[model samples]
Target chain A: MSSHDHHHDHNHDHEHPRLSELQLRVKALESLLVDKGLVDPAALDVFIDTYETKVGPRNGAQVVAKAWADPKFKAALLADASAAIKSFGFEGRQGEHMVVLENTPKVHNMVVCTLCSCYPWPVLGLPPVWYKSAPYRARAVNDPRGVLADFGTELPGDIEIKVWDSTAELRYLVLPMRPAGTDHLSEDELADLITRNSMIGTEIVTFPAKAQEAAE
Target chain B: MNGAHDMGGMHGFGPVLQEKDEPWFHGEWEKKAFALTLACGGLGQWNIDISRHARENQPPAQYLDNSYYEQWLHGLEVLLVEAGLVTEDELKTGKANGKSNVAALPADRVFKALQQGSPYAREIAEAPAFKPGDKVRVKSMNPPGHTRAPQYVRGHVGEIVMHHGAHVFADASARGEHGVAHHIYNVAFTAEELWGADGQGGAVHLDLWEPYLERAR
Candidate 1:
């Protein structure tokens, strides 16, 4: 099955003619729930808006940047991730308990929920489709390097790839190492250098072009 | 339930497809599915563990065929029916037989509800069974209900790296009971220990609760 495409050739018992079967099913379910006073449609709107627009990896980037800029915060983040993260007002839902894995020269950390799509929703937002897909869930633990390679990341032979399988309530986020030649940049600029994948550990933070020039 | 959801270390699936700048919801239906699940969950009829079990309890063939959101939608339907809030006939007919007594989660409360998420960590009077640096084996048992222990580490020995205080036990929670509190730990397993010759030169860490573990023999 193609993980990217939602379209499948399942035999439908009934058809809407215009809408897909799944779409029609959801609409019917929603209408039924609303009619029964089981769920508020307005509340559903808020739920969608929260994840779709509000919370995302930018929150994680700022956390990483603060840790990079302030050693005290870094120590606190490493020590108690939940409280340190809550200082930024980004704790709730799937991210009640948190752990930050620091990637260093000797070790690279990657997070995966082998059982289901358990992610740090407060910091990193909802997991990307690839992270939740069967292939990733199956391979990440047994073949960390291979999974990294799929994400276009290749580490040195010596760097130990630590695969964190989030099997319980504690959520994990990778604190990617700051790239070289980024010391001159401000924390905000440093946050700009961090990508969603970087904090996810599939990609490493890299020196921006301006920072590279400034270093020289 | 040893189902398709326990996919770690398995094979035959294709490469991990990474979409550039992937959106939160792939389709409008997915958004509805996600929101509906969370909103219905707020009704307090079922816990997250029960919800998870609903998703994982599907037949392997059916579970593997459905998308992530498809699975969520399926699970939500199952929960609604099991809770007596809805019926299969009502779902098919697209009509509610009667109104629900539970108040719907209001729009204004959605933000606070999400921001202050339901925490699973529980206070237990008992001390942790094992300490850091202690070796333990994941018990090899196929539980008929919900469990957080993954299949790959099931019979493997690992060292406890850190002890996370007591948390809700998922297996008990799936049965709609207030879960039994168990001390959780971060167990570290070498790649070689998990996958014999196919093992990569790395390590895997899993957050395991007390019930899933025993002293390594």
Candidate 2:
């Protein structure tokens, strides 16, 4: 090893080589909380598991698929998203005030939180890493077309892009236009095709055949 | 406050790093941070608005440098200290120095707490200042405190889309006060209004509290 590299190692002999500064801080905080009898480490696992599996993008996908299958339910969802979403047992916290945005042929909708990471946790679970990233936050508002392009969602020039800035209390859920030739599909089958990105307006839900075509 | 968190219309943030098949949490620390914040938040000592202010009131450099959960951890620490639940020395030593005035959220109640999430909306006595379809201009005042108004939306005119019932004003709630209740509206601003003539062809809808707006002629 070079002499400078050896000296660099010597400069930080007190610090733990494996853990970063932030990681060490987190460990310290956890240790203190556990030591003080303030937190149960076991509960932490439960919290993570709940959001990770029990409630997630699948919940949102079901809401979208159900809306696609039932016109009356779609009307209710369009009229009052907060009430309709609660009917599915997805309510509270970030989703107390929900607004469903429908994307038609003439208008496309996209969602972004510019102020902070205000998302519909109950319906869509926790947001993706990119949804909360700095680049997406700034660019989503300034260049909606560019942000859509990054996701490989290229729309016709005449269709207007309606970007929803989730700046305040309300969280948006984008209902993408149903794919063609899927009229025979049931709600469960359609839910399987729905992705987290499609409900967020970054992409459109496609049939299994189209997905395969894109893959090829 | 016009903090780095108000990053609408700003530039130079670079491309978003998209991860394929990403997990819910990056590591153990993030999971702990999330649980601790929610658990402590269940204490009901301070509201969500106060917690948000704690994260936003950081120095620009520190705020930008922090990851999502790091920001949460940072804010949780400040709130814990400010609420007198834990001392700085206790935080540093990783041990309790003395008897704590606060109580921890019991493990059994974690699921109940998660299921019964805190709702921000509250009943208010006053009528909203504006109604739907009315044109209103966002007040252009920048305070050095917590505010929901983004820097880019200030002083711009937009049409009201819907009226959300009266709720707690965030600025007052951030300071641990009983903020006066007011109506919130979904203000629809055209991209051209917010970003000027060169702005893109689109519309940005925002849910703004009554205080942040004034009727436009």
- Candidate achieving the largest DockQ: 1
Output candidate 1 Cα RMSD. 5.3
TM-score of each: 0.94, 0.92
Per-residue C-alpha lDDT of model 2 across residues B1-217, encoded as one tens digit per residue: 9999989888898756566546688777778788788877877889888898999888999888777888899899999899888898888777778655566777788877876776667898787788888999999899998998888889999999888787778888887787566788888899899888868887888888898999997
Candidate 2 clashing pairs?
none
Q: Candidate 1 residues B1-217, lDDT tens each?
A: 8999999999989777766445578678989999999999999899999999999999999999888888999999999999989989999999888898888999999999998898988999998889999999999999888999988999999999999899888888888779588999999999999999999888999999999999994
lDDT (0 to 1) per candidate: 0.88, 0.81
lDDT by residue (A1-216, candidate 2, tens digit) is 001111111121233233477688888887787677677777767777888778888888889999999999999999999899999988877887888999898998999998789888888889987899888988888788777767667788788888888766778999988888899999988887787877888877776633321210
CA lDDT for candidate 1:
0.88
- What does DockQ give for each predicted structure? 0.52, 0.35
Model 2's TM-score against the true structure: 0.92
